[model samples]
Target chain A: MNPAARSADGSRRVLLMLLLPGLVALGVTFVLPLLWLFRASFASSAIGAFSGGDWTLSSYETVLTDPFYWLVAWNTLVLGFNVAVFTVILSYPIALFLARTESRWRGVLTALAVAPLLTSSVVRTYGWMVILGDQGVINSTLQALSLTDGVVRLTNNSFGATVALIEIFMPYAILAMLSGFGRLNTQLEEAAAMLGANRLKVFTRIILPLSLPGVLTAALLVFVLAISAFVTPRLMGGGRVFVLGTEVYNEATVTLNWPLAAALSVLLLVLFSSVIVIYQRALRALEA
Target chain B: MTIRTSISRRAAVASALAIGLSLLSPAAMAQDTSVTGTVNVIGFSGVFAENYEKFIIEPFEAKYPGIDVTYRPSKNSAETLALLTLQRGNPEIDVALIDVSVAIKANQEGLFAQLDPAKVPNIADAPDWARLDGDRAVAFSQDNLAILYNTDNVKEPPTSWNDLTDPKYKGKIAAKLGDTRGVILLPILTKLKGGDYKESIDPGMEMLKEIAPNVSTWEPAPDCYAVVQSGEVDLSICWNGRAQYLHDTQGGKIAVALPKEGSIGQTNTIGLVEGSKNKEAAELFVNYALSAEAQATFAEKSFYGPVNTKVELPDEVASRIYGSKEAQAAQMSLDWNFVADQYSPWIQRINREVIARY
Candidate 1:
């Protein structure tokens, strides 16, 4: 071999050695389980059939054809989209403030913004239940002030789960947006104002465009988390809401139908893949 | 006081005799330095698991110090079944504790071994109702299904199952759906409205559809017990034993009633793994677990009715459970083996037609 080829081969070997551990870890944790799941998805769901029983497409056929499964899928996507939009809307101001603020309390405020992430989502979901339950503080206060004749149903439904999911996911959006705002310059806003642009116009043209990547990234993060969320929906939806995540859990654990659960999971993976594809296209279009 | 004393005295005497007799034969079991293998077991999780470990497992370990008993807890019976089915033949779990319905499903898959009566003699004292899965598994505990109402909100406690659909309770009932609770509800509602659940859950489905609007939450947050305790809802269709225990723990804020039409019993069963290598030790654990002494202790502590009829509880404790004949009479008959088949299909039906539609 030529000297150039020898060096290239050595460098390739070094790269492989560097990447080997991560590749092995991913293979063991991710790839292996996925393969097992694929196998399980095809396994027979007939009476007393353990995972190795027989290979068939019945599980996939059930998931694809069933209107109930479609309803769950729709619920999951709707939750994801709503959570993403709301997270961005709710978190943008917090991120902007943290990025631009010079006040001494900015650090403490940022800390406060990120503090809820330290607590488990399960705890926060329960905290929401305490606030939104039928006889919870909101209803009690509303009744005491005579603002309402009867207690409004604020919880154990889709609305409550959505609200809680938005809150639970907001911190992630804020952090992501804050990181994206690293290159944002104050001079641009001042320069725009000097050129006779209004405050809203300056923000719309300069700031929003600069932070569009952040907003998109944050939305993607929140959307993915929201779709895959298990505890919050299950607890808050009160078994009334059937999202893909909860449906998967119900099939695997409650029904003890591993094949159907695996098929549902495979569908969730397909959804995630579609999201990644959309995200890439959107990012590419933005760059273009 | 007298009952407690007499029970304790008898228990003490029985233990003394048991220990004396344990060393001789296959009939009674004891351990020495030779029996040192671990018996890995999986059962219930949460508070019940902690208590079971402390009350039953800890004592079993103390009695047979050389042999180690490792207890792994799964979230629920279905999870256990998933694990057992996955690890079939090359079995890691020496024994399992699961709900009756799940136990039937697992046994159908050949996950559990047939119990030898000679090895575990305590099965003789248990009721015929407790023996299950063709002697592959036997019930150890029971928690009956019933009505639970918040004492503060409910001026009049519910007296009948039909009260769930009463106009006054519109949007005030916390109904637990799916799993054993939902499975039990379908059949009971079907029977109440003159239909058989097994033949067709349509009538029960219709009954639930009627009750759906009145349901404040088809799924209660945390659980039905917590919602009732916090006055989130005035009524819950839940297991009686937990509610009865909560009644005392939570300062009489809630009350459990069997309702005029009666309710069903949810039995928890224990069995040996079919391919367990530690058979002798596992059988010993099962035998010890089924003893009147072990049963009495768990019953006194857990509020769950003991399956071993030989275990005598105090009037205060017994009154709370389906321990007495009258309370047992109120237990509506259910074929849990049949439920093993109906469970998933019924949940899907109720979810789509009833929970989704309403």
Candidate 2:
């Protein structure tokens, strides 16, 4: 072989060596667990089938056939979509303000945006429970301000759970958009302005279009998270709201129906993966 | 695969990795051991575990100096069940403390060994209802479902299940959601309406629906007791042991009431693994756990109602043990298996048709 080719082979070998540890770690942690989960999804409890003998689709059948499961899936989708949209709508402007400003106030705003992410999900959910409870701060404040006659229904309802979820997950979208904003080329905006275009025109024509990738990425990230969220919905939704995550929990734990739970999880994984792939493909097409 | 196919697969894998990493911190893995070096026990995270550590664990560890004892605590049975499942083949956990219903479920799953009654002679002293159950599980402690109310706010707390459903207490009442205690309430409610607590639950659902709007909130844990103690909630359904603890700790502000309509109770049971590595050690531990001395110590330290009839309990504990010979004459325990089987469906149905209406 040529000396250059020989050197290239050495570099390739080094790169492979460097990547080995991560591959092993991922295999052990993610890939193996997912395979186990997939196998479990097909499994039947003691009643429906014998102890791990046949490859049956009864679990999937039950999940597909059940109206309640469908309701849970619908609720999960609706809640996830609402949370993603609300987080983006609320955080985009804040993220923009932080990126555009050079003052200490921008730092303060950024810190405020990310503060909730520092706390554990359980602790934060409990905090919202206190804040959004019927007799909690929100109701107490409303009552004191004479905004309502008595305590208004808040946290223990679907709307309250949505608001709490949005609050908890808004930082993800904000940080995504913030990184995109950080990488934005300011020269193009300056050129548009020098050409007599107003700030709004520059933002709409030059900035927003350019930042679409980041916005889409943020939405996808938040949506996936919101769909799988278990704690917030279980706590804030007052045990009334049936979402996919809670449904899986109920099936696996209470009913002791592992196959049904596994089937539900498989469905969720397929749906989630397909959405990400389709979205990413669309983004690639738009970029091209 | 083709180069393009490989590249795309890599991209997908990379993105998935990024997403997972960004979302969650890697959870610590439990150490896997081949040798039965020590006995690790799994249980609920509460006064029960605290009492176990004080009375049983401390004494057992001291007595068996050669062997070590470890207690792993979890908040929910779902998590505990998951943990137990993970330790399935290896059987790292020697003993597990779970609810009576879960013990039945675990027994069905072959998660527990057939406990030898001969080894644990103390079990013979337990009530016939607890022992006669064909399952391998043995009832260890009893918990009563009662209404805990603040004395200052409510002049006269409800004495029976009828008093609980009173329209006046609407919007002030709190109860658990999707918990064993919460499910137990259904059968109790059904029983109150001259209906079967076992077969049918429509009446109970109706009762819950009627009180749905009035439920200020449905708490998952006994956090309501702290709220009631602080005067945040005037009334809520609470466990008897937890209620007793709260009443004792917080003073005369809160009071516990077991209504005349009769309430349901749950027994926390113990079972052994089917293929336990340390069969001798596990049997010895279980036998000692149900002994008269252990039961008395548990009652004194943990405020749990001891199941060992041979043990002489303090007056406070005697008053709380619902199935005690004296207490059983007045109260009835709904069939536990019936409660366990129906609980999931009833809760799911209520979540859909009733609670969702709000």
Candidate 3:
């Protein structure tokens, strides 16, 4: 072989050597466990024991046929959409400011945006519980204002879970939205303004369309995260909101039905994969 | 039939050893140094884990210096059972502490060994109700369900379960909707209404629905204790031991009331893991844990109701535990094994019928 070709082959071998560890790690941790979960999902579980019996489609059948589980799935989907929309909506202005800011404190401001992610989710969930309880800050304030006769129910419902999730997911939305703001130019908005476009029109004609991909990606990220969220919903829902995530937990740990948990998890995985595919297709079409 | 004989035989052997050991001095009851190995223990986390380690475990290690012990804390009994089951093939945990229902389920699956009474003579000290699974597992502690009221918020502290449904408590109560406490509440309320739980828990379901309006939150985050102590809710239905602990720790912000209508005990059990490498050491640890000294110390400090009938506690502490004679008489005995079967379904009912309506 020629020297150049030989050099290229050696570089290719080195690249594979570098990639080998990650591939092996993924295979051992993710792929093998996934296969094991799939096999367990097919196992006919005893009511309150380790899930193992003859392989059957019973678990999946139960998940698909059970109207109760379907309702939980629907609730989870609705929650996911709400959390995604709210998180993205709340993050858009901040993300735009961060992307456009020429201030020296931009780094610190950006760090503040990501700071909530540093605290453990459990701690954050507990904080919400305290703040949203019956005689909590909001309720006491409302009562003091004579807004109503009694304390309003804030926590322990879908509303509480949605509110907490939007906050918990805001950082992720901002980061995803930032990726699409790369091509955003102030000159385009300026030119549109000079053409007698109002602020709203300028945003609609230039800034919004330019940043649409970021918004979509951010929404998708937050949606998937919200769908799989266990702690915030579990703590905030207060046993009233039975979503797919909480039900999966109840089935797995409380009921000792591992097979059913695995089946439900498989459904979640399928949902996530579909989301990823849709995301990719939309992005490709937008680019095309 | 065969299972019965082996269990009776085991019981006979345990009693026979107990009689002889009663003659020996207390120090002699400690195991011989020949059984030398590590006993891996698993149990609940938070204060329970800390106290278990400090009270029962440290003394167990000191009493039998030969057997080294390693403590591993888990989130709950369900998590412990998952660990025990996963490691069933090559068992890492020799002895485990779990809720009675989980223990019953674990025993059914043969995850726990038929605890050799010969090895664990203190098994005789456990009362009849506490001696579960025909001596395969025994309740080390009891947690009674009780009404926890905020001292500031609740001027007239509730004395009966019926009081919770009163108009005064409307939108001021926190309840565990479909958790273990809720499941156990069914039997208690059923008994109160003169209906057998096995026949039907409709009486309990109806009562819960009545109390639903008062329930401000079905899930109290960070636990029922925190919510009540903060006066976030006027009252809660929670475990007595933890409430008592919080009552003292929080300087009387919370108070526990064992309603006159009576309540049920949630038992925490310990047993030998099936595939333990150091069975003798593990049994020694289990025996030490069941001893009166260990039980009394643990009960005194942790406020967990000791299952050992021989253990003596203060009047106030005694009232907190279901172990005391008066409280024991007041408790409605639940067949946890049967309840284990109904557990998942009961949770489903509470969610679909009771909580859903509210």
Candidate 4:
């Protein structure tokens, strides 16, 4: 072979070697199970009929055609979007604080952000339950201070549960943004200032544009977490609210409809993957 | 120059430490499968884990020295069912100690390995009432749903399901929900309104709605005992075993009573997996699990009534469970199949109507 072709072959082999472990892991753990689940989704409820019981689209039809499933899907999307928006809003300021703060307090700031992530979701949500419940610490304090006449209806409310999720997932976005800010060079801002540009102008033109990557990363993380969050919504929302995660849970566990649940899971996976791909494309376009 | 180098070195060290921490977490958790020859049974919590291990696994492992047994406790039947479904084909579980509702569903789904009663003689000792279709499963223990109330909260514990909805106890009650269908309340609720459990949905739903506002929360876990123990709710719908356990551990704050109309009783069952490698061992284990000694141990520890009639429990244990003549006579048991079938719709409706509004 020619030298260039030999080098190309060598590079391909090296790439394959590098990618082998991840590919094998995914194939073993995820791909094969998903394939089985896909098959199961088409299978009939009749026993020993693993195959050839009419490969119908009935399961997918059930999920897509049903208003209940659609409602859950819409709720999941809304929850994801709200979480993403809130994470960006909350984490942007926190990221700015971490990036601009004195070095001594950086550890403390990071610790405060990371503390919630380190704990179990169930424990954190349960803590929220105690704080947000009727006759809870918050309500009791409010009452004593004459802020309200009675204990507030907070524990079982959707808005309260959403706030709890936002609080729980904020750290990831903030941390990612902080790292992004660290990588960002302050040269453009300094150069802008040298030209007598105002601080606001310098920031808007330089820092905001530079930090877009990190902000995107944070939003993506929040979206993924919010969409897949089962425990927080189940426990704190008290099953009064429904989402795709809970719907999948109810289908598989409560209703014993494996095919339907699997179909729903597949839909979720597809939606999540599509969103991620679109996000990356958008990020690339913005960068260009 | 030395000072600048030292500061840079300190920064390098900090970066290394942060990177190390981030990398270590996933690596630490990647040690996922270290299965070293053990039998794993996943199911709900209670005396089943302890009794099964003590009487069944330990003895079997004694006979077969190399075998190790692991018991995984699930919070509820639905969770157990989910876990089983997830672990299908490559089941991390060898056996599952599950409720009748879960077992029946599993049986229908071919999740369970059917047993030959001729192969498993201990199946005979299981109460006929506890058997499902005389085929796939056998009862190990009965977790009877009894009326448990804090004596201090009421002058007398209500003798019927009707009294629970009385205005006197408004906003001072709690109830079980989700997979815990309160099958025990079905018969009593139906009989109180002069109907059978199957035809009693309207009345039952009405009954639930009356108490819905009063119920502080629809506890989906057996840990509802802790709620009562904390004096958060004056009275609650609780299991006999839970009441017995809490009363024993924390003190006699809660008293368990079998209502005159009779509550629903549930029998927790054991069955062999359909494709078990060791059907002989599984049946052997089940036979021993249903033995009188095992039953007594389960009764004493879990406060659940034993299905084995041959087993004689201690007076206090017997009195606390559902095996007593009065307790047995009063129990208004319903068809578990009916509950399992209708449960999804009923819960969805309840969630939409009562729980969401309340």
Candidate 5:
């Protein structure tokens, strides 16, 4: 073999050796647990000292046949979709500002945009609770200003939960969009503008099309996070809002039905995977 | 050869140290069994655990010098049971504190060790009702489900559960769902409507549907306490202990009323975990916890009613608790085993039929 080819082969072997540890770690931590969870999903009984017994499809049957669970599933989907769409729409301008600006306060502003991510989501949800509660700041201000006759119920409803979820998950969308915006060729937009394209036209035709990948990525991230969110819905929605995540928690902890929890988790995983697959297909078609 | 000699010398020194430590361990253990090892306790987290530590665990540790007590707080009884089940045959927890219903279930599952009367003599101090499954578990504290109303908003204190159905309370009541308070509400409603748990809960369901429209929120306690305290809701159904504690601590903004009809009694239990390595230490702690002094201290500090029959509470504390002995005697006694079997179905029905319609 040529010396160059041999050297290349040596480097490939070294690369494989480096990758082995990570692969092993993922197998043990992620893959193995996932397999166990899948097995637990089929257990017959959800009671007693042991978690598993005979393999059965009863858990799946119960989840699929129950209209209550279906309602909860629908609510979960709607919440996830709404949060994802809103986060992307609200994040685009911030992402653009962060990516395009060379201003002195750029770093500080970016840090401010990302500050919510640093705090615990539970703490942030509680903060929203205090602000949006019946006698909270918003209602009190409204009452004080004579803008409303009585206290408005905000915290213990879907509206409050969605608002809190969007706030908690927005930083991820912004960061994803920023990364996408950073990759765009600014000269393309300049060229379009130089050719008499209006600002709106440039944004719609050039900027949006170029940022599709980032927008899609951000939406997917936010959707997954929001759909699987337990704290925000539980705290902000205050038992009024039922979702798949809360159901899973209720089953596992309150009801002590491990099989049902595992089955529901599998359903959530499948739903997310389906969404991701369809999203990728749409992205591919757009590129083509 | 020199490197080999050095390795041998190091091995010999390590063996000598291991032997010395093993010899010292028994002597250390012999001096005082209480202080020599650690007792891993699993119990409620948040305010309850803090109070438990302050009134019970700390005082016990102070009395039994050299014993290290480690408290691992659990979110709830079900979670604790799940953990105990997971750790069965190789128990990580020496002692566990959980809801009485959960204790019954755990006892049925054989997760607890039968308490020896000689070891836990204070077990005799507890009421007969408090003792469960032939002393496998014993109730340590009790709380009652009561009507809670905001002092600023409620002009007249509610005297009956039917007050919740009054049109005057429309859009001013906060209902709690998927909690012990919510579950007990059904039994109370059933009894008020001339039915019982063993017979039919249809009347209770109908009543729940009627009251559902009045409810503005379904936030559970602690949150429900905040809602009532903030004067956001005129009234709520909550536990007397927590309501009383919050009322006293937060400047008397909330007050609990034991409805004239009756209130449900919720009991909290303590048990030794099966297969515990620290069984002796755990038994000592359990015995101490069930004693009149410990029960009285916990009751005074947290406003929980003590299960120890020997505990003589002060008038102030007793009045705030389940009220007079006659009133306490009137408090509804639930068959927890039956409730455990029926809980999930009832919750599902309430969620779908009642909460969903509301």
Candidate 6:
């Protein structure tokens, strides 16, 4: 072989050698466990032994046929979608500000936006609990202002859970949108404005279309994170709001029903995968 | 040559120190030689673990200089069982302290070693009911469920379990879901309403639904103690040990009530993990844990009722525990195996029918 060709082959071999360890690590840690979980999902309720137990579709049947499981599944999807929508809406202005601002306070604002991510979700959820509790700051202020005769229940419900989830996940949406906004060329919007187009028109026609990918990316990230979130929902919802994540935790740890938990998990995975696939296809069509 | 001379001199000094220690405590020296390894323990975390360390683990370590005790704390018995099951093939933990019902389930799963009475003579001290699966697990401590009320908010203490359903407590009662204390509420309610666990829990479910509006939170994640202590909820259903601990430590703000109907008993059991590397040391630790001295100390400090029949707690401590004959009679007995089997469906019903309706 020629020297260049031989060198090219050697480089390829070296690259494969470099990738081998990571590939093996992922296979052992991620793939192997995932396969084991899938197998466990099919086994009966016998604990300890992962295999050699009666193999059955009972776990999946329980998950599928149970109305309670369906309710939890619906709650999970709705929560994910609502949190995603709310996060995107709340984060857009912040992202735009971060992208457009040239002032020194831009860094301060960015840091403030991302500050919650630095602390644990559990701690932040606890903070929300204090603020939104029955006799919390909101209620006290409401009482002081004589807004109402009695305390309003602001927590231990869906509203409290959603608010906490949005607060925890908004930073991720903002960062994703900011990255997208950074890639935008300002000249198109400026030209649109010069042509007597209004701000709304410019944003709708030019800016939004250009940033579709970023918006979708942000929504996807927030949706996945929010749906699978255990701490925030468990703490803020006060257990009044049941979701799949909490159900999985209860089944696995509280009830010791690993097979059922695995089934529920696999269901969550399939649902999310379908949604992601559809989303990607739609995005492709939009781009085309 | 100089390095070798210095090493030999250091070794001679270590030998002299060992000789001195052996002379000081010959029994410790004998134990030190026999059980010379780390006994890794998996058990409860939080305040209970702190008390265990102070009352049981520390004393055991002091008594047996050769056996080092390493504690790995778990959040709950279920989590401990899951861990044990996961580590069944290559067991990492030598000893485990978990809830008795969960220990029974784990035993059925073949996760615990059959505890040899010859190795652990203190096994005889525990009552007959305390022993399970031919000594695979021995109950060491017991905690009872109790009604906890915030003293500041609650002027009239609740004397009955049905007080939780009172209209006055509307939007003020906190209950933890997916916990033993929460699940036991079913039987408590069933008995109060003149129903049995065998026939139907519908009466209890109906009562739970009726009182659902009064439940401020159905799932107090960390615990019901903080929620009650914060005065967010006037009353809660919680374990006596925690309620008593919180009452003593948190400025006497919380008080526990053993309703006239009685309370459910939650027994904590300790066992040696099957396939443990340090089986001898683990057995020694288990035996030490079941001793009267250890039991009395733990019961006095942690307010957990001792399962060892030989334990002689002080009067004040005895008053706080379910140790007296009358108190023991008042303690509700549960078929834990039945409860374990029924837990998932009951929890599901609570989540769907009761909490969802709320």
Candidate 6 chain A: 10-residue stretch with minimal lDDT: A45-54
**What digit string (tens of lDDT, one per residue) describes model 3 on residues A1-288?**
999999999999999999999999999999988988888888876433244557888899999999988988888889999999889989999999999999999999988998999998788777776688776788788889999787788988888889989988898899888887998999988998999999999988899989998999899989999999998888898777888888888888777778899899998889889988988898889878
Per-residue lDDT tens digits of candidate 3, residues B8-127?
Answer: 999999998877766755674665676789999999888888889888888777777787899999988888988887788699999999988888888877888887778888998888
Candidate 2 residue A165 C-alpha distance from true site, Å = 2.1
Q: Residue B247 in candidate 1 has what lDDT?
A: 86
**Top model by TM-score, which number?**
3
Where model 5 places Cα greater than 4 Å from the true spot, the runs are A1-6, A46-53, A100-108, A182-186, A193-196, B1-39, B54-70, B117-128, B220-222, B291-297, B308-316, B324-326
- Candidates in descending TM-score order: 3, 6, 1, 5, 2, 4
Clash list (residue pairs), candidate 2? B112-B273, B112-B274, B113-B272, B113-B273, B113-B274, B159-B259, B171-B214
What is the per-residue lDDT of model 2 for residues A1-288, given as tens digits with 9 covering 90 to 100?
999999999999999999999999999999987887787777666333223555778888888898878878899999999999999989888887777777868878898888878898788888887888777888889998999996677866678779888988888889988887755678889999999999899989998987777788889999999999988888887666678888888777766677777788899998799888998899899989
Candidates in order, TM-scores: namely 0.87, 0.84, 0.89, 0.78, 0.86, 0.88
**In order, what is each prediction's RMSD in angstroms?**
4.6, 15.0, 8.4, 14.4, 11.2, 7.6
For residues B1-358, could you state the per-residue lDDT of candidate 2 as single tens digits?
6999999999999999867755653321122232234667788787767778888987766556555678888776666666666667778778887887777667666787766777767777877666524537777777778788888888987677677657787667777656676677777777667788656888887777776766766744227687677666678887777777767776868777767665566677777666678777776677777777777777766556677778787665656545344444556665666666776677767666666674
Q: State the lDDT of candidate 4 residue by residue for A1-288, as single tens digits.
A: 999999999999999999999999999999988887777777665221243356768888888898877877888999889989987998898888778776897888788877788888788887887788766789889999999985566765466569789888888888888877765666777889999999999888887888888899899989998998888887767556678887788777766666777788888988899999999999999889
**CAPRI quality band, candidate 1:** medium
Clashes of each: 1, 7, 0, 3, 2, 0
Better of 2 and 5 by lDDT: 5
- Top candidate by DockQ: 1
How far residue B148's Cα lies from its native spot in candidate 1, in Å, is 2.1
Q: Give iRMSD, candidate 5.
A: 2.3
Q: Docking category for candidate 4?
A: incorrect
Quantify all predictions' global Cα lDDT against the true fold: 0.85, 0.75, 0.85, 0.71, 0.84, 0.85
Q: After superposition, how far is residue A88 of candidate 4 from its true place, in Å?
A: 2.2
Error of 6 at B165 (Å): 1.0
Runs of candidate 1 with Cα error greater than 4 angstroms are A1-8, A46-53, A102-109, B1-39, B50-70, B121-131, B288-301, B306-318, B323-327
Off by over 4 Å in 6: A46-55, A104-108, B1-38, B60-68, B89-92, B117-121, B276-281, B312-315, B322-329
Total residue pair clashes for candidate 3? 0
